[model samples]
Target: MVRKLLFVATLSVASGFKVDQAPVKTALLQLRGGADATQIAKYVAYSTSAFMFIPAGRDVFSPGAEIMPDDDKLLGKMFTDKSKEGYMFMWNQWGVNWIMLSIMKILAVSSGSADFLKLGFATDVVTFAMMFKGWIPEFKPFVVMFGLELLALGKLAFA
Candidate 1:
């Protein structure tokens, strides 16, 4: 998984970046690890260490939620939950991850890059397939945000 993601990361960079990779990687590494994108890309590509794995329980954020002050803040409150998947799921939806994902898809590309993008698109599909399993709240906003962003990138790659 890590190797595949590393390949994808290399390919994404090879593709092209309207914005660059160095600054982005620098910022994200500061937020998480130096290779946070590699981590996310690895997780998205394959299930790694079982104990280290984080189950992305579906519906942690469902539709039609009211805008009231959520007392529990339980929708995506994995940080304080002390549960198995809470923190993993929450961390996946953070700003740094979002930025990294955006950077991955926005890199330079050529005809030779088609296969890598296809692989990336497939990986994303598998990741989304895990959503809404009813095991955790469906982090709706993040679900839509991350989902649409990747979908859009996949579309760009195919186009």
Candidate 2:
């Protein structure tokens, strides 16, 4: 029974180590031209859209005590509507960011350099700042996103 318990513990530790190293391994592989360009592009698309949604959601749901005037334009109204505001705003923000990032990623892949990836990552950092500008005055989200962006930039740069 003691031997079995030790074996299980060792296996669990090894599994956790592998999980932590997965991203690094993938980054090394990508650097060696072993990664698929299409797949990388897809990841960039998904990640940027997902990141943009966070701010939009916060804006709609957590606008704080101050209320802005109702926007009169169609797109503005759709995004500012009380009931469906969060979803609409998220969708709208995601759409714009997604397109921009998609183009940048495509250009990066085409040029065979990771500069555009870094640029995209930087753009995200800025977006996060703008997103939380007046809402919370908190640095936690920005810091977290900054760390993630650094990791992403490192992966792309080495790729």
Candidate 3:
């Protein structure tokens, strides 16, 4: 009985330290040649953000948009149906920021640098804070956007 118990213990200990012959693949390993998860996630995040301009046109981009809760909204009534200037201001603001981020992501991917992902991570943090703080109203599309940002953040962090 004692011999059998000792043999079992030894086998368990040996198996615990057993190393697989196969190379352990990771995101870092994928970084060498082809597109890694980080690059894909970054591209997805930026591209999705850029395309948001289309869907948002009904709200912030148009004059007399229906989404404005109040005329004196912080974003400015002029940007809403209250005035032409306010609408233009909000529209340009969205376009510029979204487009710039997308361009940065493209540059980062093509250059094979993780530097630009840092910006994306930071932006995600701020956006999340805004959402949680109620500065930005919660909506179904925003939830989806938040999930994409989270995915990018995870890849950025691990990579």
**Number of clashing pairs per prediction, in order:** 15, 0, 5
What are the runs in model 2 whose C-alpha is more than 4 Å off? Answer: 1-94, 106-112, 136-150
Q: Write the per-residue lDDT of candidate 1 for residues 1-159, one digit (tens) a residue.
A: 999999999988977755554654567577776755434543433222111122221213321233333414644443455455655555455534434443444442222256665655665566566655533444554455446545544654565
Better of 2 and 3 by lDDT: 3
- In order of appearance, the predictions have TM-scores of 0.34, 0.34, 0.52
User: By lDDT, who's the top model here?
Assistant: 3
Q: Report lDDT (CA) for all predictions.
A: 0.46, 0.55, 0.61
Better model by TM-score, 1 or 2? 1
The sequence of per-residue lDDT tens digits that candidate 2 reaches over residues 34-133 is: 7665456446544644564445444445532122322122234234445764765665555555555646654664465667767766776666666567
Q: Weakest 10 consecutive residues, lDDT, candidate 1?
A: 48-57
Residue-level lDDT of model 3, residues 1-115, one tens digit each, is 9999999999999999998796566776666656666667767766666665554554345534445334234445234454455556666667566667656655654565666
63: Cα error in model 2, Å: 18
